[model samples]
Target: MFLLKVFFLLLQVVTVAVYSRADIPPPPEPEPIEIIELPLPPVASAVEGSCTSGTGCILQHAGLVQGGSFLPDGNHVIARVNYTGAPAAPDPASVYTGDQIILVKADGSSFSNGSPFKCITCGVPQDSSQGKTEALDYPQAFRDGRRILAGTNIIDCGEFDLVSDECTPESTFIHPIRWNTAVDGSGEGGSIRELRLHPDNLHIGFNSFTYDAGKLNQYAYTGRLALNSAPTTGLPMAPRYDLTNVNVLSNNDTRNIPLIVDRDQIRINTDAITVGEFRGFSGSGKEATYIGYPRESSNIDVFAVDLATGDVRRLTSHPEYCDPIDISADDEWMAIMDTRGSNRQMFMAGMRNVPPLTDIISTTATSSTRNNGQRRFFQPYLLDHYGDRDDYYGQQVNAAGDGSPGSINDPQWNGMADPRFSLDVTRLVYWQALVVSPACGGENPLPCPNSTEPGGRTERLMVAHFTSRQPVPVTDIEPLSDTISWGTPYEPGTVPSRELFISGGVYTLYGTANGSAQVTIVENGDAIETVAVTYESYSDDGLTFLDGTENITVRNPTVTLNEVDWYSDLTQRGQTNATKKTSPDGFHLSIDVNTNIFNANGTLSTTVNGTLYTQPANGT
Candidate 1:
């Protein structure tokens, strides 16, 4: 599916409407609970090679559903399952038990080369004492598929053994602890929870941290590796999620959180190892934060983290929101999904500080265009497909640097959002789930569903077309039942070149041989002049007057010369006239000249050299 559509869905979850009016009811509050840190479970063997290491995966019929996501490398993909909950479990012939995270290549190729993407049971090992229904619902088998960071759920808490690649019943997933348990002082207040991890997956995001779920706190606390002793003050929150954005720099004593906030007013929960905390995050993976109506105003802040000093230096501060920001394999250009206006257009910004040259590429599902008095503008807007299917709103709002559109006559974005250049970003070669509203496109916008039971829709890969510049339409036509997506361009420099002409002609070299004379000419030369010459010659064949008068400068003319040398011979052919010119002086004649002496030049000129022309022998 298209990358823009998937981003729209992610924004939806964060931008749930909360009316500020007193007459309106407050947003639903998260339930409260306890805070208990559990030790990671022991590793279990794969039943003596029962788990054959698969080479690849092939997906039959699956597509983007919701909570769309891509792999760390942006090459592999993980999407929400399209099929709803499986039939009541405990049946003798059930293919799956708990939630299964479907893994597939962006092209739907299988790990074993030819086989389709097969599902793996991630359910935790069931306890025999527990009923069969409960046995099938193991935590290990329930793959969240959405918030996968470093191959684990973002919410699963605690530090697991980084050595073995084995997962067990005790293996924690993303944010494994219930939200209520993360509260600090009993009853209801939220705690500054820290989700730390050994930095193995740096590509997904350098280090990420979000404020507590319920409240927008004044302080944003993060844990990082430091040389100083643990914090003596502030709320103490331990690592409660499996997927950590902070890197355990040098045994967790010195870690780094690459965050960029307007002010250093945020707090760091030094009690636990947290990487970094930024006010905004948007670019794919990196540090992304989208908070608004549908969370469309997300931004990714790039910064450097000092493991020892805990210093943060801002690397990128482009006001536009970019998703899946990536440096080219060469690291010259950085590719990102710039959600500057209504569309999640792909853009590339120069790392240098000279204003950052940027180019827009595609439009997100929620992108919009607008009209001013005499001019028109496009701001960040989304199709409101909430509640009723047809209730889609296409209002335009400026996603200004302050995270809000200021005015309709926003001249700062005159030609800024115009998609005139190709994006410099490249997507991973993996397929992920992409959600689309019916208001945007009816039925399947990318892949056509087969209407079959499980294998209904064709798997849609989320490829980043980093080089493409054209706006790929998200039309739900045939073949694509409902799932429709476009890949970023793989070939760069595909932008069509405008044609201009300089008056010119085709040039060719020519060589000519006449009797004992030969000449060569370069049909085209840089000289701007044309010259013509006439020459006389004698032939030993007694045909001296043959075509004696010919134009020297004819179009594509071929000039030849034949100089003859007659020898005194007394022999006769059919009774020779021996009496008249007997003993006539045997004259030696030769033509030594350069072919370039006579050349033609229209608007341009060419030269023909005759240094090779020779007349050695004529008669015996």
Candidate 2:
């Protein structure tokens, strides 16, 4: 049943309406609430483990576990391993054989190795330091129990047979399209990175770079491969780009790396492909907009192509580097990492005038033409800077004093990367780096000499709630305050009393707990409805609700309570306290809650049309 759920989630597709800035709705006004501080739960001890010489060496280093994902049940975690080294010995031979695919039981008591998925023609270099054999990077398991693996030179699909609980050799597809021998030394040899599986699971997309002679070329292609293909037959032919009217071949002069298609955008019957094209290299000497690269050559601009119709449209024309990171699930907004400024920042722009499938596929053109007089499609609003600290550079000290730390010794903020939206499009998560001082030996101010210095740097996972506008650190342990609630009142003028019909409004709550929690809605000291709430993990977070949790909503609930005494679990530790205010005209209900427990003494303004109620047990 769990496997079936995973399979359906992979195949699920959704579409959202694109809107212009003028058509976009304004964000909801913030709610009002008072917070009472409580002691945080005891921080749990670190999960302790040690790798003895040869037995546990693989788990010792930093980059060994490059990327991973858990199965639905979370009893197993599948990951791509790139062995670096251990503290005792820099590079251990037993572990550093090459890049390996591995599956470990969640508790670390057992593990299964899936390595030597050998490339048919690719040769293993005699030199051990050249890096792992084929150097596989990202490995992901599909819902059907198949694992898709990517490396510098090849991509492999490992088929898992449920009966034997093993990946059979014949079921694997080892494709060398990205690492052809003719291309390897011909200066045309390229590496495939950022491999993404399309929604259909049959098609895969990725960015590949090849340097031939004096010119450098980048291409993005989605190819068709069957799950049951014979391993001895070699991988399928390279995906054809020209067939889709994506001219990576003819326009070799310009760098035309395809922007990754948002997985959400690849649904049943969708033909549009989003990509980034370097405009200045057209050889036509057109005016360049992005200034990140040489002024003589512009940086990359985002464009969308219709595979079915061959129609192409420019989506953004920012003067600075505005690269598409990911599109929102609804396709209404696009999240981009804007590098126009000194520090990398996250921004969102309304997706406007997106061409339909019929319009995109039916149009015929040898090349995409710029939409003349079209307003720059991307009018990005700044979300947040990738790094919190503004005092120092990301690495090594320089004479310019850019790397000097301020008095606080705050974590040196590195640029943000891999910004992705939640499936619901209400939250965003990204990776952040901070250089911290090691306890023993390091620079006085820290993060100065360099991140390579004794202590090294710390990578932090961060998340932001679009509606809440607050950035929170993602901790290994679950949040103490797991649930938050907001409510609205109905028929304001119909009743003169402070009581309002909350039953007419939907009540939504967000949580970070792993299992189910009982949500009891109360009215006038009586429990009206007690519903069991189950929490699901987001993609950015692991199977556990350690990152940011999911949101659950109760619609049209049957309950009416005084605005002052609505929430039932206010006195419960780690539970949220909320208050609702109606506008003077009685048209809208403004609900607010003290969401963060760290700022317990926080107070809300009482001048609105609602009374502030305090719990006698825990005096405010």
Candidate 3:
């Protein structure tokens, strides 16, 4: 009789819809934001471009794939290159010898000019005066994947023959890792950024940036790395590497929450696991991925929490600009590094659910436009742990959006920061650079193209191979029999195609590669096995947790693993401005199930929340 009624707010009243520094929401009247079209994710690419060396088609090239990791015999990749053409000992101009730490042969196999790569920090005192300055930036491979932690150094140059993946830079040495920070000796020191190493290979998860009071703090730590028997009391002679039990994953604390409908109106949760920045962990380390805080306005997404259970999961939701990520080792899938299609933050996340106001104060001038300086408009998507809902946005590992200058999705060839996943998840290792000069060559009206790769070198090295093992989200009547898609974007992070579970009982809960839209698991009506979610509470008990601006998977999902997707912008009953071709018209999907705090050690979460309401008609 009312024709329409919809409201899914976590409280826009006293202001608790998220966007921090404290809270911001005040500018709305300007309007023009609406880019949304983003596509390319079903899977196709096989080898991809920009993998220079001699240009022989199958990986085995070197120099241009900085920062990579994925070696437990899934072929190979442990990069951090520099070498921009200068072999015969030529340009000792301290080009830093291009900051070596090589080895790339992502198993496409079949090449041999005598160098598939094997130069651990290349030429360091390892021999022949081949030293100019070894810089090694983001390497990671330990768990006997053959030693390495990079940038607190710790490398091992020989005897690493994973069946000739090769190694032996004449015995290199670059140890450095003594960061005390304060064990109580008055404290005075700091410096660390994105250095993760915790798959229990002995704890470690870093990221620090201090300045408190004057503001500018972005912490997220977890420590345990000791090798000191002596010598690090202040660096006697630089004995190196010592940090113990540090812990700080949610001590910035700030909860208040109380408005399920003006229960008096409170809402503060501030930032516990709702994290504003801290991106690493979760290969089963239990979950900690971060960068969330501006859920609507500035939009920058990517979240994942649940280190023992503070549970939150919002992993990337378009809005352009996603920060490098990885998560796949029997945990479903994810490989992020997005800028969507480089429409770059779409003015301020393309007006989706609106209400972020000036982001209060510009949110860093609107997330620094994703990149213009450090060059990173990013491009590398591959989701499915229930991330990116409704129309299903994922699958662009390098489909060659082809801006051409060097291919492989080359939008200027950006994309960097920890894009790894290999230990049988198939393969996906990354690196790319090439916008060049002061941000863009010469006179800078936006020139810089030139280097078409054969060592003309600006940065390259990417490997994407596929097979299939995570896609299953059916219902075209009963569609999902297998689903497994062949991998692409660029290729090689194998397990090529997947999408299983969900049939007789139904509990399926995901379906949108093209099948339209589906999200099941309703019980008495059908489908059931498990579904206990608590992701930062909205409370309804029994367990299903997800509402308001809802984030649909990018990674960090666990009720055991994946399935909490809910996009809900709801509003269409004769629509006003045609919200995405007539969104739900009056849709309220709460599907209740979840009961108070599950694990800070309390241990208890088993999900089944249900209560669906759909009224389609208007745009359809």
Candidate 4:
């Protein structure tokens, strides 16, 4: 029985081996593999190398556009443009080659002569009997929309009228004005760094230098003139032009009388409100305010001085350097640029109620108490906070010695400057330089040959829209939907659309939107409505995409009275008119007025009573 079982087991093993071999069959012949190639997509080419439509475009040869201000209607911009090369030396026979003041559309099209506006005094040599023509520097649009203000390298400060295409020189201080000269041969005074026209359009504030007792002194002075004043036709009087006699608001004299508010410290509100540096009281009312290192330390804090009373109170405090840029139309908030952190950034602070005069003049207060009190006046909140990604704005990492060939590539890195608010306070505009490259070439941390050198940067004019009635996180700040190199560098005083007063009406403005983006209008702390706006990638030849627009939904949209024709349909129909006015606090209130009607007898009748009431977003 054992022998028979062993034989059966051997047979079973042989059978299993045979079956496994059968299942393996012969290895199939290797099958041939197939490969396929796909065609590449077409490349889109730009029209004339110009970016006509898109989220952003680069204006390759637009020259250096500086000191830009949007027109009152936000349709155009006025700026100072310096052509690609340095100006020729001033010569009596040579043509004036100074910088040009120009008006351009939002689409980068020129409104004035596409060429440079002829400089009024460009060809006259410095010592010519005809008097030297000064070069135009900064150009700013007036609130009225018809005029612009610009500073000269000499005594010829003036305004250029858009309608007349002429520059009218204004009354300036009588001093030996010098341009581009070193202290040795140059006159005691220096060129005007800033020229600010008062809101009344009658007075001007400027930063300049004057020789006093063999020493040059810097001052912030005010020049006053009657309303509707124009510059005298010829050369200004010399040695000291006191025709418009300037009052020294702040000076660098030994007495430090009145304190020194540098040009950077002056902020002009829409209502002509001026806040600057003042030094009436010191530690326990002892020392002069403008006596420290950053040039005016003791009096460096911002102050709202009663120009009428000579009374002044501090608005901001120390550790962080604060320079006021602008004040809201309602005077409820102030925008500032401060160096509180590693870099300077834009900030906004609520305006605190002025303290009682009694508290300000108290003599027994300690320095600590005074500083603490001043600190309470403003609680600053950062506006452009980029955290670790601070480089969203350009970084100045490659200085001369940090691995670069020449200083030519030294980056024009900029921190946030020129914080501006719309007249309605619904938008804010500021500028920053963004870095495009860390190193110019791949595999080498050095500038590439013929390429935009390493650390290449571009200036961007950024806009933030306040869409929420309630205060939102700073991170939610809205940049203008489009991207373009929109502004100049280092100009903190130009506020685009700051004076644009759009009365209550509806109108359309262009913006870029994607399918995921929505247009929202918030009223009285609620998102009253939202419209889903879509964008289609458009190509003129089906290869390159262009910018397309979709309608944005707005509730009780506002338009400027300047934009409406009073004699048109509203008056002809004798329709009752009602519109909402937005307060600084974001509340909407209705203002109702009956239209002027032409009586059957042809006499014009005026509406006697207008009503004001709270209104919903739908105007119900």
Candidate 5:
């Protein structure tokens, strides 16, 4: 589940910095929703206590998991964790005696000395902790329920047997068998990413990078795992495994040599099998999934290229960013992490199907915009088997409940890579981290929202349950807004709405509440009065009013004096109650407007509120 596929950008990302325009700042992130623990109902608490608190939750905390998956039993999870309790910790193989492959209860509960976990290696009596460097980034638990084909070798956690609700570890059960990691095992000595083990259990698919001919070339490859009679490599001890019959999917000149006809706008790159990075295999294991060369510039999506036929099918079509994908065993569902509702990429690719040819050159910029500093604006989405068909992006699993922190669907806790489905397809397992400083607060421009996930833990593994093993139906929904990009101080930005929203700030952020309405008078079949009004009405999260609504009533059907405009300024807590009286027929009108000043960014929210009193007959 690599977020940014091109690791070669390590150069540009280190040297250059990307910032949003100063004036039209990135919209403030929503306030932190409070974290509260809720006990599952007795009926739903049937899940095992080893993996959960026995709480059958839609989104349960599966411990402090990072890039891990459920084992063959569909009960416990396996991730390479460190003693420091931090991911990507300092030298995972060197820090705290190098991180060992440990399995913890999904609730992040640790026993004495981090016990109660099924310690497959390191501290177990059957394990050998001396001499060898222990490390793994992508750990794959084989279906055999014993061997783990993780980084560089196979971790034989002989039997994942648990006693007293714990994976009882034995030293004799664990040993490492080194393998020839890649066709060119030259990076960091050896490395592979976005690694996937095919269902056949004999072959594997992955992506790797190699510097060749003074250029850094990254390619996707598939190869068979074998125990060679001869020694594989001198780096690790002998009696090792090797990747035989290796096949490089995108290393050849399969892609067209781009011809820039008119600058970068009209460049020509053929739709060859240009696999950028290997994602994984489809559920059926017939087609291999990867992030292909951009079909539409700046819109990076998932594609399944047939391993046999070389035909390609686009799995996702959203203009916003998406990566970190997994297909269900039936290939009917796709669980992925994305930035659809965050408006994170709205600054770049949110213009929808109408992308500019010139924007083709900015694909890297567009892809990188999915992240900010150390934060990723990703949330889990459940796509149907059809991928993104017309307007149908997958369902946001967490978008359902009231998105309070620690709840199943808290939007503040951003999703992370590699969502895996249970073998039975009843559960989806993934991870997330709360957004904190630098990406939100601190010297960065965005407002500092607090973390409601208590005790200050940043990331956690989340598991979601489905009622049944059926694919969610798909439907198209045209979003309510468009944006104004590339604006500067000389001309500030503008936000326009479609038929769905009022002309306000919904485009700035999704899920923000607002309102719009049109009132008409049909007196004597003549066009007498028509009032069209648009408003901002998010609660305390709103941009305009805060607590309550404003009411106005007028009784004047005979008088006609309609040529006056009026306004009022409200304090932090106040309502405007004004009455206008007109002569001739004792015309009277009362307006009670309740407005909140502290709602959000604008003097209009604080400064002015417009109150009108008029009808078919007029008033002053």
Candidate 6:
């Protein structure tokens, strides 16, 4: 019975397995493998050679171009290309291409002239447009013409029509537009009227306006967008001017009427108004200008708006044409490009004198006198100005100050003129338009020196100090590569152990300096003795304050400002790196304390607890 049951089970298994195998049919011999094809990707390459319209040369890359210019700050150069071959305006549907202009720095790094290149970084392609071009007329220094404003926006080429419909039906295609520019690091962009960057609040003069009917007959105004003590305060301060019926007669007789608008003052209930004097009045306090062709017209005026008092001041009223004008903090000085004729010059005026404030101190039992420094006022000096020659306004020619007769290379014709000073009043720069003689008339005869003569500009950067004072070279400051290692003076060959990781001392318990320094103290609680181990060197001397104390304590904490003393004996000049050390209780100190303690004689001294310590004539 067991054998029969096993046989039945085996037969059933064999039947089921064979039925499944027969239906599979050996997996159909794996089928003859089939192969499929894929489409190829499009390849791209740069346009190899330059092509002009009607040449029938198709480039790997081509397009119509719109115009392009270097941004005012000269940061990034952009080249815009419109496929439309003509000078026609942008049709919203036209295709355009843009390329970023990049510059390689002295450090071997490349930066964009502006926009996507600054702050952020990127790799750029090399092309012929990367070099300088002579076709562009860029901004030159107001004085030193040779300085050749470093970062200039230059546009070299432009492309026209690319689309068949946009191009004239019978005409062919032209290339695209390309531009190059350099942006100065000084530019900061925001859609505001004023800028107050710390340490460099007035770096780029914007936010202020100038109006001049004539000297003193004119008034100047600046936007005090942020007033002291009150963030809620608005515009229009004292010394207001109403621009009603005001007119300026330029030497060239060109007249401009400004448009004015009034808006609600943010701080007060009244409305603050700004005259629509210029075309591009983006609230960002940046200056803009348009120079007259060949000669600049100095006819200019600015309306000042008071946010708080709804007042307007017409800053100036002068017959001469004015171009560049800059105002100072506290509304004290007004600097401008004054155009008289042969005397196209720069001028400054003192507006107001700052005052000193005093506060009384009366104790319960006694009274003492505590005087803070009084504010001193200075009279404004007239800077360089070049006026018109003969009857021609804005014609470059030599002029004199106070109507004195100054000789040009030939005073009768065009010569030394257009002097502009640096903001610090340290250097005077002037422009001399020269008519170069052509050698083509042989070295002998030129074309009678006509107005078409190639005119050149000159600028000079001078070191100007006060009268009887020699100009100092404050630039090109070199850094000190090596300084003496400092710490507690130690005995020769005695490897001193420090409770702190690196620095340790045993003589003084005066005080300690706080910072990222590691420190440790050890004492037997017996000696009240004091030991001062200081490493001294000659440095531009500064001041440190301290309070009286018997314990090894630090008293007054001293802060160092960059105010330099010309008399200091510190060998190195210009900006220098400085470091200091003081005690934990605020009494001990170490510094470049020996250099300029005396402002007159350049003497060397170190002050400790109100007592000046004189170092040997030549520091040890």
lDDT of each: 0.22, 0.26, 0.46, 0.27, 0.46, 0.19
lDDT of 4: 0.27
Q: Order the candidates by TM-score, highest first.
A: 5, 2, 4, 3, 1, 6
Task: Give residue 586's lDDT in candidate 4 (0 to 100).
Answer: 27
Tens-digit lDDT track of model 2 for 309-397: 23333434332334424444334434454433321111110111111111111111101111001101121122211211122111111
Better of 2 and 3 by TM-score: 2
Ten-residue stretch with the least lDDT total in model 2: 1-10
Off by over 4 Å in 6: 1-299, 302-315, 327-335, 341-420, 435-620
After TM-score superposition, the amount by which residue 86's alpha carbon in candidate 4 deviates from its true location, in angstroms, is 12
Q: Choose the strongest candidate by TM-score.
A: 5
At residue 375, what lDDT does model 2 achieve? 8
TM-score of each: 0.30, 0.37, 0.34, 0.37, 0.59, 0.22
lDDT of 5: 0.46
Model 6 TM-score, all chains together: 0.22
Task: Name model 2 segments beyond 4 Å from true.
Answer: 1-50, 53-81, 84-133, 138-145, 152-193, 208-213, 227-301, 309-324, 328-335, 338-417, 420-429, 433-620
Q: After aligning candidate 3 to the native by TM-score, how far in Å is the CA of 263 from where it should be? A: 7.0
lDDT of 3 by residue, 426-527 (tens): 667777767666556564556677766653556665766554433233212211111111101111111111111122221112211111112222222222
Query: Could you give candidate 6's per-residue lDDT for residues 1-620 as a string of tens digits?
Result: 00000000000000001122233222111112111111111112233222222211111222211111222222212222212221112431111112222111111233332212221001111232232222212122211111111122212111311111222212321111111011221111111122111112211111212212110011111221111221121121111111111111111111111111122101111121222212111122222211111110112332333222223333333323333333321122233333333211111001000000000000100000000011001111122121122222321212222322212322212212122223333322222222232311234233223322111111111111123223332222121111111111212222222111111232221212211111121222321112122222212122221112111211112221112111111111123222222223332122221121111123223222333333221111
Ranking by lDDT: 3, 5, 4, 2, 1, 6
Per-model tally of clashing residue pairs: 95, 6, 47, 6, 9, 81
Question: Tens digits of per-residue lDDT for model 4 on 1-620?
Answer: 00000000000000001122344333222222111111111111223323222111223222323434444454444444433222223422123222445444433333244431223333333332122224444444445655555543222323434423454222222122222123232333234445544444334445544443222233344444332123232233222222143344432222222211233221111122222222121111111111111111111233443343333333344323344244433343444444333211111101111111111111011111111110111111222211111122211111122323222222232223234444454444443332223222353243333313222223334334444323322211121111111111111221111111112222221212211111222222222221222223322223222222222122322210001101100010112232212232322212211111111111111211153322111111
Tell me the alpha-carbon RMSD of every candidate. 33.7, 25.6, 21.2, 34.1, 20.4, 36.4
